[model samples]
Target: MERDKGKLELIATQRVNANSEMYKVVDFLNKSLKNYHLMFGLTKKDESMVISIYEVE
Candidate 1:
């Protein structure tokens, strides 16, 4: 499998609410890992809360 090196790529996702403990963890990871090239995002779509981890550019 070959993939671009610097492209924004999704690493993982979870169907969990942003108000849950999962969000806090993700937020912590973001704060702790922002300088390490990872980005965390939380969103609500279609009546569900979604969290995503990405390898940022």
Candidate 2:
């Protein structure tokens, strides 16, 4: 039972780490997308970034 708990903890930690990395990727992508939109004059709001263009439309 202790071993199983340890494994579960490890899995949860890994998932949190993965989620952190994913969030970082999302931030980077959002910054890039915002830049692209600014270059194209597609968005005027400074808050818009990283989200899908279709969603904005």
Candidate 3:
């Protein structure tokens, strides 16, 4: 941990276009990864969906 917090390291990222159902996938991944000290994040960039995976420890 850095500064008393677990450092988040980016493991993967992808940008998908024309997919409206991607939130469901991110939700599922978040649920599944919670117990493993991992996180799934999503962002809206222009017309694309940006997804990322981070390790919490």
In order, candidate lDDTs are 0.81, 0.32, 0.86
In angstroms, the error of model 2 at 2 is: 61
- Which has the better TM-score: candidate 2, or candidate 3? 3
Which RMSD does model 2 reach against the true structure?
17.7
**What lDDT is obtained when candidate 3 is compared to the true structure?**
0.86
Candidates 1 and 2 compared: the better one by lDDT is 1
Per-residue lDDT of model 1, residues 26-56, tens digit only: 7898999988899988887765788888987
Error of 2 at 30 (Å): 0.2
Q: Where does model 1 exceed 4 Å of error?
A: 1-7, 18-25
lDDT string for model 2 (1-57, tens) is 233321211111111222324556555655776534321112123433322222121
Return the clash pairs for model 3, or none.
Answer: none
Candidate 1 global Cα RMSD: 3.9
TM-score of 3: 0.75
lDDT of 3 by residue, 1-57 (tens): 345367788999988894778889889988987889899989988889889999887
Where is the poorest 10-residue window by lDDT in model 3? 1-10
Model 1's number of clashes is: 0
